[model samples]
Target: MRQTIRNVSPMSNEGRNAYVIEHLTDALLTLLRDHSINDVSISELCECAGVGRASFYRNFESKEDIVRLYINHLFCEWADAYEQGDDKPLSALIQSIFAHFERHRDFYGLLNERRLIYLLKDVIIGICGPKPEQSKDDAYAKAFVAYTLYGWVEVWFQRGMKESSEEMAGLFKMQGL
Candidate 1:
């Protein structure tokens, strides 16, 4: 999900690139608190991150790529935790997803406030949507599940996310969704 310039080779120095990525990510999120992604120039971001423009260009293609990559990184982390957990039921999975969002409420709340929550749809779909190898019915089912999950998250954010993750999972159970 992290989009980098094609010319940036994977053989580049890993440690330095990781440092640059972390700093840029933090800087971009900090700036996003007070400015739209469009309002913050790449120079401003580089200066805030204490990295040069070449580093920025080396790591990311656009400001939005930073957000996309961060969200994906967070989701991958959540996925790892979910995989390690024992309970794998539908309701439990729903609660885990909501809890993951709850754990990062500030970041998510900011996205909601900025009307950028739509960005999350891609993350969800990329993780859960149909794969090419699946049968048509299976693929359709996966797509349905992914979209339905996104719908719940969107409504939850729209409602100011007052309900606890447990309550949201309970609603899913009650509705048999």
Candidate 2:
């Protein structure tokens, strides 16, 4: 049976596109539970999502693109929550990062289990990586921070995330980072 699509108003193009995106994302993730991304086809994904092929192409270039989009969406959500919090210290930021991952353990765990966590690296870098216009030193600093944070995340996932967010933040604080 096709999964039920939600939250789209019948007449709005934006709503319809959102519906397509949501369904296709769910479809791809569901499919991934049983098949590798390479083994999943566009036709199969479209069928599973209950959307036409044209609908799929209109919203995403490929299955990986859908996953990337979803990852970005999740980060945007975390950023919103972070911005709302008053404490903006480095340790707090680090703790929030770990907390966000802990909150989304199932999705992140799936990525880890399926070896798709590499897809998260670019998204993390894009969100915090250096901009092209920055000076060499500034660019290097940003790159260092971004890659270091990604390293923490990767290692945490690989280790089955035994540490709590507060504990990880404490480790970072102890390191004088």
Candidate 3:
């Protein structure tokens, strides 16, 4: 049973991919609030989104891929919001990230509980981008940064996010990152 998806603008020429991604993301986030990603089946997700099972496969390799693609989308948004000649401080970037996550706190909190936060790894690496001058050590540093941020985010979500996004940003600022 396929359900029609509306309200999605293709982020790329891959209109079908974009459509599936938007609907799948909505369904996954909605479901993650109540269930672990590991427990989510493709059929259940497709049913929730009113999308077809074949469509889901065409857009995503697995359930975790949805989270990764969504994170990619978030990173693209953050990058787009940047201004040329801007300092682009790490604190500013981290703040934007935390603030964005705050908007979907419940969804991420559940994912953290299920230890699916590791899914952000690829997204982080992608954000690191391709630096021609990047050395092996730089690659390690990038991975370290990604994993560290993931840990802090998981902790924040697990602790019920008592700190406001500003406070979280301040914490990083104080650490000189």
Best by lDDT: 1
Model 2 residue 135 lDDT score = 97
Model 3 spans > 4 angstroms off: 2-14, 83-85, 128-132, 135-144
Per-residue CA lDDT of model 1 for 96-122, tens digit only, reads: 889999999999998887778999999
Q: lDDT per prediction?
A: 0.88, 0.87, 0.75
lDDT of 3 by residue, 2-34 (tens): 333554343564876767778889999898877
Q: Supply the TM-score for candidate 2.
A: 0.88
Model 2 clash pairs are none
List the RMSD of every prediction in angstroms: 5.6, 3.7, 4.5
Residue 167, model 2: lDDT of 98
- Model 1 poorest 10 in a row by lDDT: 1-10
Q: 151, model 1: CA deviation in Å?
A: 1.5
| Count of steric clashes across candidates, in order | 0, 0, 1
lDDT of 2 by residue, 42-70 (tens): 99998899888998888888888998898
Alpha-carbon runs more than 4 Å astray in model 2: 1-10
What value of lDDT does candidate 3 attain over all alpha carbons? 0.75
Q: Residue pairs in steric clash, candidate 3? A: 3-50
**lDDT of candidate 1 at residue 63, scale 0 to 100:** 89
Task: Give the higher-lDDT candidate: 1 or 3.
Answer: 1
